[model samples]
Target: MKKLVLWMVMAPVTGLCLSFMYSPSAVNHPSSKTGKLIISFRNSVDALPLELNKTYINSLQEPFKVTRLKYYISHIELDNTSAVITPDANYFLVNEEAPVSKTITVPFPAGSYHRITFLLGVDSLRNVSGAQSGALDPLNGMFWTWNSGYIMAKLEGRSPASSLPLQQFEFHIGGFQGRDNVLKKISLAFPGGKPFVLKAGKTLTIDINANIQKWFQGPRSISIATHPSCTTPGSLAKQIADNYAEMFSIVSVTD
Candidate 1:
């Protein structure tokens, strides 16, 4: 009877000690206070599903088919937390072909954030910095050879506008310098500038829809037939980049 009571009493103490040893409170306790941010990318036309290789006409009745659409969004930051989640954890290569690539996550310290900001393209620093892995990896096919920089966005498809042999168009836009600086830093505020609280162990989700219509109907309407690929940095690339400036919009946010 005495031994039974002793074993029971010591068992509780032993379990308590093991719990502390296995928990994160012993190491980087701050990580325990962090939550997750999920950003979703969708290809759509006026909120409808976008079909690849299917002919979709523009305002001018020009028929086009989007065989490929890929882009990069980097250097994301959220306001209201002392802890920082930098580009490496935030940059993403959004590809329409890869359904799993549509969502990107950022781990941040749990707190109330009033604003969120991110770059539309990979910054100049990262492009010339040298080879990287993960989303920025060259094997992903977003990087450009010879020019020694990333192709911020690539749009490949066919259009009746193309009188060429293949009736195809390609736009590989990427530049971080003056005149050709296509990188756009966009800041979005929560509804009514309200702050959204990130609770520990909870994830916050935001939907970002890339409107294809805006690509064909922005400040300057694009005609793939008249204007072909933008393989290099120049005015043509800039013009195409300008049109895509309105490509992204925050559709919804859910906790």
Candidate 2:
């Protein structure tokens, strides 16, 4: 009877141990329902790929060369047919000269998404949260003083149209308070309104084009010759922000 009781307990324990040892490891499983979403920014001027120091004409018919171009993208959200998924709250500095900085990757779950939305500038929360690290680091030159907040977008270059001494134009746009706010939220839908299907363990890349010309012409016409530099936040900055808010468009999506 003692041996029978011992065997009964040991049999189930042994079976449990064997089951755990033989079960497939979740980490090694091939059916993980997680994927990656890559967002790539392609800067362009008049439909041509942007190259630094290459002369291009703006909508105002002014010839200029971009010496530097940088902007912030944040608050990314993916919208599915049934739900909205915010992968994470992260800020990305897309530098026109930095190839690696142009691509942003986020871990996403398998889903059929139709729309992707993101902020073109850092949100007010992070702006008021004091100094930060990583992409929000002040050393990145995106942030102004803590009181002035961050530079939403910066464009610098030389143009004969510029009235500055060196024929240089600088647009350091920044503001987060009241009417000075230049934060822009941009939403893009897949081509043909088709659903973008992301499979498990696979990666999807979304190519976005930022037309530099849109900065000069959209709702308002900004003449480089007349207003070459806007370094502070005000009505001109807000107008520029409104113009650039329409700069991004979906170019393509690939697996």
C-alpha lDDT values of all predictions: 0.79, 0.86
lDDT tens per residue, model 2, 86-172 = 322378899987899999987677888888888898898888887588888999988887455899999999999999989999888
Alpha-carbon runs more than 4 Å astray in model 2: 1-32, 80-89
RMSD of 2: 6.1
- How many clashing residue pairs are found in candidate 1? 1
**After aligning candidate 2 to the native by TM-score, how far in Å is the CA of 153 from where it should be?**
0.7
Q: TM-score of every model? A: 0.82, 0.84
- For model 1, the stretches where C-alpha displacement exceeds 4 angstroms are 1-30, 80-87
Q: In candidate 1, list every pair of residues with a backbone clash.
A: 161-225
Which numbered prediction scores highest in lDDT against the true structure?
A: 2
